[model samples]
Structures are given as structure tokens and as C-alpha cells.
Target: MKKISIQGIKGSFHEDAARKYFGEDVEIVECRTFRKVCELLDRDEVDGAVMAIENSIAGSLLANYALLQDFHLHVVGEIYLHIQMNLMVYPGVKFEDIQEIHSHPIALRQCSEYIDQHFGEIELQEKSDTAGAAQELAREKYKDVAAIGNQRSAEIYGLEVLERGVETNKKNYTRFFVLSKHNNPIAGTNKASISFQCGHYYGALAKVLTIFGDNKINLTKIQSIPIVGKPNEYSFHVDLEYDTEDNYERAIHLVLKNVSSLAIMGEYKKGDIELNKP
Candidate 1:
């Protein structure tokens, strides 16, 4: 069985993403932080790591991007998890009996509208992990404390879900990146993630982007992050998808001519958000 590292314990969203991308039979090595996932991959503690890179509502995980660069890990695959936050409590604990609510900061923010409309006065506490809060409440037999997590957490922790889909938006999604020591290429590869530093001159960034258009590569996402220890200079990370491998190769060939530091982070198939629910 292949072992994969994740940012949170069992029943967390990262585990769900891992199972979804790598199959349900894979072993999960839970880590306390995202950087720990990188360390596990670097130290050969696991075969690969599943990490949340971006959320529809919360935006990008900037520090994780830096970790990928620092660790020299390759993005091998991607998973789009539909994050369905829930309100779970100990068995037989009714909704009205709840006195306090706990969850990770991101989960709390995602369900802010629901909490404000129903239980605004409830004392909200942010925990390090969403499923950890549920596990704690169940283990302690806290009848008055509720946790906001996922259905998997409720089942794993022996808690009862009092409310389902507590998120403000029904279309909540998080993009997870599968990282490893080396690239694991799948058949029909057409998408890629690349990072580079462009000359800090007029049209340098535009020239690289124009090359993609000229070569028929579709730019999916682009982000700029500050280069540590170098003020005012930034590195650009981009995700590009192409219909043909030839077009992608031509674009990268042209792109490298215009950038100072270029790295092909990964070349893999694009994962769509519309996959059927399991």
C-alpha cells in the first residue's frame, strides 16, 4: 500500500482528497502542518503528499507555495474536493443544547453566515484542526460543545451531525496538489505548473504571457510572490493547460527565452472540478 502524507489527522479534508485522488486503499500519514507534509516527502517518510493549495473562498495558501519551492517537490496530481462543512455534536445532543462551537479558522469563516443567522451568540473557538475539535468533543463527551467539520469526521469520531452543509456557499471547493520527490506522469498529459522570475522591465511579464497565447496554451492561473531576501523582485507561478503537447512544448520553449529563473514544476493532466461525487 502506498503511504501518503496529509496536513491533518484522519477524517480531515486532506485525507478525503488523498483518498479521492490516490484511491481509498492508500495509507495516510497525518502531519500537524503543511510544511511537515513537505518534510515527510523530503525525508522519504511517505510516497507522496496531498496538500490544499487553494480554496474557492479563502484564496491561495501562499506559504505552501513557498514550501514547495524550498523543498523541491514536484506536483504530480491534483484533486478538487467539495468541502461540505457540518455541525456535529455528541450523540443525542440536540441543537438547542449547544453552548459553544469549535472548528478551524477557515471552516469558521466559511460558515460565518450560517452561524450568524442561527447561533450568533454561541462562543466560537478556533482549533488547529477541524476534525480534531470533533474528536475532542466526542472523546470528552461534551454535550454542550459542537464542532464544525465534515461527515467523515462525524463518523470517525462517533459524533452526530446536527447540521449539514453549513457553509455559506453550496459550491465550496478546495484544490489540492499531490506532491512527491519525482514527477509521476499520467497518460495524456497536457497541463503544467511552472514558476519563473521575469526581468523587472516593461513588458517582460507580458512577453511571456503573449508567448503562451501565440503557442495556443491556455493560462489557467497566475500568481506573484515576493522573492525572499530580494526586495521588490517577485517570482511568478502559473498553471497552463493545452489541447496538444506540441503547443505546450512550444510555449515553454518561448517562455524560457524571456524569464530569468524558470522551473517546470509539473507536467500532468488537469483535474476538473466537475467529477462525479463518490
Candidate 2:
């Protein structure tokens, strides 16, 4: 059984993603924080770690990107999990009985509609993790308090789900990356992630992007984050889906030839999305 490290406990989305990718029978090592996930992987304490890279509702998880730059791990695979935020509470507790709800800040923001409509008189408390909030509620046996988290959390903490898929947006999906100590040498027929730094000049970014355009590669996402200790210096994060044998080498060289520095973060299998049933 391969041991995998993930941030948070059994019910978290990270853990869910890890199970989805590695299967249910694999051994799981839970870490309390995201940084710890990277630390364990760097120390070879586990085979790999799963880290959430972005959420459709909240956008990119910048902290994970920072950890990618700091750690020597490489992305081996990608997983896209459809996030269904559920509002759960203790059994026999009515919605009107709730005085306050607690969850991670991101979860609270994602389910703003439910909070605004039902919990008008209730307070919203931010916790370290959504599953952690659910666990705390279970431990304290707070019947009047509800938690906005996943269904798995409800199952793990013995809470009853008051509502399912309560997120304001139905298209809520979070992208997670599987990180390992070794790079994935095998090629796949899917998207690629790369990081690069462009020279400080006008149209430098435009020129770098043109390489993709010229190669007929569809750029899916792009993000810019400031580099530490370098004022006004930033790095570009890009995602594009292209035929590996057809355009991988040429596209990389073209970008590297034009850009000051280029780093191929990883190329892995593309994520598949299931169509929502009405």
C-alpha cells in the first residue's frame, strides 16, 4: 500500500481528492497544514501529496504556488473535484435553532447565498479548516451550531446535512495537483503547466504569449505572483493543452528563446469533468 500525505483529515476535499486519485485502499497520512504536506513530501515521508491548486469560485490558491516554488517536488498528476458545499448540523436541530455557523473562510464565501437567506440573524465564524469546524461541532456536541462543509465531513463527524450543494455557484470545482519527489517522465495527451520570468520590457509578456498563439496551443490559465526578495519582480504561471509529440518541444523552445527564464513545471494527464444533471 502506497502512503500518501494530504492536508487535513479524512473528510476534507484534499483527502477526497487524494482518495479519488490513488484509490480507496491506499494508506493516507494526514497533515494539519498545507505547508506540512510539502514538508512531508520533501522529507520522503510519503510517496506523494495532494495539494489544491485552484477553486472555480475563489480562484487560484496562491499559497500552493508559493510552496511549489519552495519545495523540490514535482507535479505528477492532476485531479479536478466537483465541490459540493453542504450545510450540516446536529440531528434534531432545526435551521431556525441555529445561532451561528462556522467553516473555513473560503467555504463561507462560496455559500454566501445560503448564509444570507437563512442565517440572517446568525454569526459566521471562520475556522482553520471546514472539516475541522465540523469535527469541533461534533466534539462539543453543539446542536445549535451548523457547519458549511462537505458531505464527507458530515459523515465523519456524525452530523446531519441540512442542505446539499449550497454553494452560490453550481460550477464550483477545485483543481488539485499530485506532487512527488521525482518528476513524471512519461508524456500524456493533455495540458501542461509551466513557469517563467520575462525580461522587464514593454511587450515582453505579449511576445511570450504569442509563442502559444503561433503554435495553435490553447492557453487555459495564467497567473502572476510576486517573487520574494525581488521588488517589482514577478513570475508567470501558464497552463496549455497541446499535443506533446507535435508541439511540446517546439513550444517550449520558442518560449525559452524569447523569455529570460523558463521552467517546465510539469505535464500530466488532463482532468475530466462530469456534466451536471439537471
Candidate 3:
């Protein structure tokens, strides 16, 4: 069984993404932090790591991008998990009995509208993990507390669902990358993630982008990360997709001539977008 490292414990969205990508039988190694997940994979302690790269609503995880660069991990695969935040409480606890709600900050933010509408004046506390909050409420038998997480959390931690699908947006999804130590070519690779730094000159960035456009390569996503210790210098991380590999290669070749520190992060088949349901 291949062991994969994921941030947070069992029943968390990270676990959901891992199971979705690696199958249910894949062994899971839980880590409290994204850095730890990358460290375990970097040290060869696990076969792979599942780390969230971006969310539809919350934007990019900037620090995780730095971790990807610092650890030198390659993206071997990717998965898009539809987030289904729920309100869970200890068994037999009524919704009105809840005084404070706890969950990961991101989860809370996703459900902000739902929370504000129903939990006016109620104390809210941010926890390290969404499922961790649910687990705590279940394990400690906290009758006055409720947690916002997924339906899987209620099942894994033996809690009761007070409300299901509590997120403000029903279409919330998080994109996760499967990282590996080696950059092995994957079959049917139609998408790629790369990072590069352009020369500090006029239209340097535009020139690289033009190369892709001229080669018939589609630029799906582009994000700029500030270079450390450099006041205004930045590195560009981009995701590109193409109908043919030849076009992609030619674009990269031209892009290489225009950019510095060019790194091909990964080339893998794009994951299909599917909504996860309870």
C-alpha cells in the first residue's frame, strides 16, 4: 500500500482529496502542517503528498507555493475536491444549545454567510483543522459546542449532523496537487505547471506569455510570488494546457529563452471537475 501524507487528520478535506486521487486503500499519514507533509515526502518517508494549491473562493495558498519551491517536490497528479462544509455536534445536542462554533479559518470563511445569518452574536473560534474541531467535540462530549466540517467528519468522529451543506456557495471547490520526489512523465499529460522569473525589463513578462499564445498553448492560471529578500522582484507560477504535446514543448522552449530560473513543475492530465455530494 502506498503511504501518502496529507495535512490534518482523517476525514478532513485533504484526506478526501487523497482518497479520491489514490483510492480508498492508500495508507494515509496525517500531518498537522503543510510543511510537514512536504517534509515527509521530501525525506522519502511517504510515497506522495496531497497539498491544496488553490480554492475557487479563497484564492491561492501563497505559502504552499513557497513550500513547493523550497521542498523541490514535483506534481505528479491533481484532484479537484468539491467542498461540502457541514454543521456537526455531539449526538443528542440541539442546534440551539450551541454557544460557540469552531472550524478551520478557511472553512469558516466559506460558510460566512450561513454563519452570519444563523449565528448572530454567537462566539466563533478558529481551529487548526475542521475535522479536528468535530473530533474534539465528539471525543470530549461538548454539548454546547458545534463544529463546521464535512459529513465525513461526523461519520468518522461519531458526531451527529446538525446541518448539512452549510457553505455559502454550493460550488466551492479546492484544487490539490499530488507531489512526488521524482518528476516522472505521466501518460496523457495535457496540462503543466511551471515557474519562471523574467528579466527586470519592459515587457519581459509579456514576451514569455506571447510565446505561449503564438504556439497555440492556453494559459489557464498565472500567479506571481514575491522573491524573498528582494524588494520588488517576483517569480511567476503558471499553469498551461495544450491540445498537443508538440505545441507545449515548443512554447516552453521559446519561454525558456525569455525567462530565468525556469522550472517545469509538473506535466499531468488535467483533473475533471466533479461536485462532491453527501
lDDT of model 3, residue 172: 85
How displaced is residue 268 in candidate 1, in Å?
Answer: 0.8
TM-scores of the candidates in the order shown: 0.96, 0.93, 0.96
Candidate 3, which segments miss by more than 4 Å at Cα?
A: none
Candidate 2 C-alpha lDDT tens digits along 1-278: 88899888878988889888988878889898889999988988888889999988778988798788789678878898888889899888898889999999989988888788877757889999999999999999897899989888899889999888898988888999988888758655567888999877788888988888888788899998777898766789998888654786687787888777887778777777672343
Every candidate's CA RMSD: 1.5, 1.8, 1.3
- lDDT for model 2: 0.85
lDDT of 3 by residue, 146-190 (tens): 999987789999999888889988998999999999887787789
Best by lDDT: 3
Off by over 4 Å in 2: 228-233, 275-278
Q: Give candidate 3's TM-score.
A: 0.96
lDDT of 1 by residue, 148-244 (tens): 9999899999999888889898888999999989866667888899999988888899999999999888898999988889886789989999999
The model with the greater lDDT, 1 or 2, is 1
Ranking by lDDT: 3, 1, 2
* C-alpha lDDT of residue 262 in model 1: 96
Span of ten consecutive residues with least summed lDDT in model 3: 269-278
